[model samples]
Target: DAGVTQSPTHLIKTRGQQVTLRCSPISGHKSVSWYQQVLGQGPQFIFQYYEKEERGRGNFPDRFSARQFPNYSSELNVNALLLGDSALYLCASSPLGGTRTGELFFGEGSRLTVL
Candidate 1:
């Protein structure tokens, strides 16, 4: 089976423009989480969704949002983007109900650049 995958591989946008990133989970998984990885920094959790319901959220601005579909695919939407928002958006997936280790598999991520 294939692992998690994300689209656009790279993205470039001017400040104030919005962007939408997409993700497909690994086979047979249900939980999806979104994270932001700034240069030289670890990814910070943005949101987590399971069964189309919001499971968890991190300390991010309201401009950051996401949702998981019934089929487990997910999309992350960022509004009123800023230069500070430029970062790698990673999508991760794990089995249903999650594991004690939170062993989530990650995608290469969509790299966003704001000018």
Candidate 2:
């Protein structure tokens, strides 16, 4: 089975440019979540979508948004990207959500660089 894959492994953008990152989850999975990893910090949850519905959201600004598709893939879109938004956008997957101790399978991530 194919593991999660993300596009544009590295991206460079100006402070105001918008950016879109893509992710394809492992086969036979349905839940997709997004995390932002800043330098020297643990991944912070951004959003979690299950069965194409928004299950949970994190402490992210409106500029951060994401969606999951019927094929279990996902995309994260950030508008008005700021210099502080420069981080590793990680896409993770789980069979389902609401697990007390579930682990996430992460993609290599789309590294965003802002100038």
Candidate 3:
């Protein structure tokens, strides 16, 4: 059972470009998934797509969207990227959601660079 995994560890994109980041949850723990953006301060809650449906969203604009696959994998897609969008995008997996019981496991994250 591997920990959460993310693809394209690093990427470079220009403003207005579209970017897609992928994530896979641990072998058998996928009740919910979370996407977070990390700048300097810390990880900011971006969105939580549960069981293939959007459960919660952050302050991000409509350009930010995501989806969860049947296999428990997920992808975060951002359209019309902005310089401010450059950050470490993190993915977390949990056996249950809305508990906030410190049961979440996170991945190393994909580093996106907007130029």
Candidate 4:
């Protein structure tokens, strides 16, 4: 009955460092997606996973990657971080086939700060 959960609510790293963010989806949900949100801007889709497979990906650079587990939990990893990469990393979950209104349940998000 819980909503999606993300770990390490905040993070700080220097440029060129790598970081990994974690997410656990809602129970019974089969789809998980990642997004990046910068201050004063909307979230940008990064990656989507369904049934443990990559379903869709946005126009992010190759440094961003994600994977879903058998239990529907997922992780997002970013390599060679840049100051421009600092943002709120969000994880969202939805039922398979998507919602009638096409909405997603999102986690509080992991805040990444790159210097």
What are the per-residue Cα lDDT tens digits for candidate 3 across 17-88? 999999998887664454556575678777786678777787888998889999979999999999988899
TM-score (C-alpha, index-matched) for candidate 2: 0.95
TM for every model, in the order presented, reads 0.95, 0.95, 0.90, 0.95
* Candidate lDDT values, in order: 0.91, 0.89, 0.82, 0.92
Candidate 2 lDDT, 1-115, residue by residue in tens: 7899999899899989999999998887788899999999999999998888888899999998888888878999999989999999999998866734267899999999999
- On a 0 to 1 TM-score scale, where does candidate 3 land against the true structure? 0.90
Model 1 stretches astray by more than 4 angstroms: 98-101
Error of 4 at 109 (Å): 0.2
Per-residue lDDT of candidate 1, residues 2-91 (tens digit): 999999899999989999999999988889999999999999999888888888899999998888888999999999999999999999
lDDT of 2: 0.89
Better of 1 and 3 by lDDT: 1
Q: Write the per-residue lDDT of candidate 4 for residues 60-96, one digit (tens) a residue.
A: 9999999999999999999999999999999999886
Runs of candidate 4 with Cα error greater than 4 angstroms are 98-101
In candidate 1, residue 11 scores what lDDT?
Answer: 91
- Looking at model 1, the pairs that clash are none
Against the hidden true structure, what lDDT does model 3 obtain? 0.82
